[model samples]
Target: MKELERIIHDDSNGLDYILVGEVYLPLLAVPNETREIGFYGSLHRNYLKDYKSGLYSYLSLSGKLWSYLADVNEQCVERRDYLMDQMMEQEGITEELKSRDQMEWVRRANNVRSRVDEIILNEMVYV
Candidate 1:
């Protein structure tokens, strides 16, 4: 388990019981690029069905959050891919390379990042 998971699991505070599931659900979902994030506790067979039920509950309760997170993850992947391409281009390999592809990817990545960043930052500031 990750250090964060360990900390959450070992926490004795009341807050742990309240927020542990919430925190880990998003963390697991984000890293795995999965919209279904409530299955972390289903590693054991006993909890498998319960895990699915929890997943359904989470999705029903916060489908928008999952969609937003997935979109953000997609944008991040696009940005990383574009940056990798830019690095490759800068290394002077151009004969078979397509500048249009490079430009489009970079622009898409930047646009996604800018929009998402604006939304997130504004929400943070106002909240």
Candidate 2:
């Protein structure tokens, strides 16, 4: 009757509950994080699942895995960009080089990309 209110707040746990049928169920909803978990996030997720099971479990259980992965993805992307810019500047990989010696530019660009990828994997993604 009066005790079965439509909604309620619990001070002990600081949570809200909605009355559903004969029980009050804890209100829950998925977070509205818009960032997509890209390649780096996927790599980090796999590493955590395979090697860091305890941390993975804690993050998943606490409803923070997605947000954490998204943040990692952002950081990885920024790091990749910064590294690429530095390597490109140092190697003189430019539009002029790309237009003139296409093959050489391709080779150097590929090397830079692979190196940057390895650095990110070891420094950010895997650990």
Candidate 3:
């Protein structure tokens, strides 16, 4: 446990043990305890800056929801590029279908980009 603490403290891996110790573990200790929610809320209120910083760091560490969003964003970009290429090709294709497909791809790409930007903005504001 001491070694774990030392590692958690020293590692730049961005683990927030304070959240773990103050909020998560206590909740885990008594899964059915209603008081755990209040304890977590109190911890968040008392250590707002630290809690936000920890949350931002955890999100930026590239494994949780942020990572998944990033991966999906990349995929969206790739698909958009492919669609653009297809639309640009001189092969015989209906103008209507091509325009529709291009619009759809652009819309999907923009949506993913917007979501990723929102996540980043949220993290920045919280931190």
Candidate 4:
């Protein structure tokens, strides 16, 4: 327990236990008989369960959700790259399709790149 306290207090490995402790501290301060105590206690217990094991794992729900979004965005970019490669290969072999529709394929590929840029800027930069 002392080691946990030391790690939490020192923000070791960028763990922000101060944030988690701040939420739970007030519950510990209030009398147990109070009506709200049980509710707050349950919430604190949930926090403990969620955060007790791993270092730097106590991020709020929004942070976790954003992390998930970033992961999905990465996968989307990878798939887009693979599909664009296939399209480019097809364009090289097909003269009619290359003449009439290559620019459209370029536009779609640009759109995918733009979406990946937007995701990196908006969703991944902060996370």
Predicted model with the maximum TM-score: 2
Q: lDDT of model 2 at residue 91?
A: 90
**lDDT digits (tens) for residues 46-125 of candidate 3:** 34446666654544343343343344445444555555445444333445654779776556555655554454334422
Residue 59, candidate 1: how far off, in angstroms? 11
Kindly report which residue stretches of model 1 are placed more than 4 angstroms away from their true locations once superposed. 1-62, 93-127
How much is 21 displaced in model 4, in angstroms?
14
Which regions of candidate 4 are displaced past 4 Å?
1-62, 93-127
Among all candidates shown, the one with the greatest lDDT? 2
Residue 51 of candidate 4: its Cα lDDT?
52
**C-alpha lDDT values of all predictions:** 0.43, 0.92, 0.42, 0.43
Model 1: what TM-score?
0.27
Worst 10 residues of 2 by lDDT: 26-35
Q: CA shift at 121, candidate 1, in angstroms?
A: 14
Clashing pairs in 2: none
Give lDDT tens digits, candidate 2, residues 13-82. Answer: 7778998998899886557788888999999999999999999997886578899999999999999999
Q: Model 3 lDDT vs. the true structure?
A: 0.42
Q: Rank the candidates by lDDT, best first.
A: 2, 4, 1, 3
How many residue pairs clash in all the candidates, one count each? 0, 0, 0, 0
**Model 1 has how many clashing residue pairs?**
0
TM-score of 4: 0.30
TM-score of each: 0.27, 0.79, 0.27, 0.30
Q: Model 1 over residues 1-127: C-alpha lDDT tens digits?
A: 5444333433453222224643643223222335532222122222323545564455534434445344444544455556555655665445443464777565655665566445543342122
Instruction: For model 3, name the residue pairs that clash.
Output: none
lDDT of 2: 0.92
Report how far residue 123 has shifted in candidate 3, in Å: 27
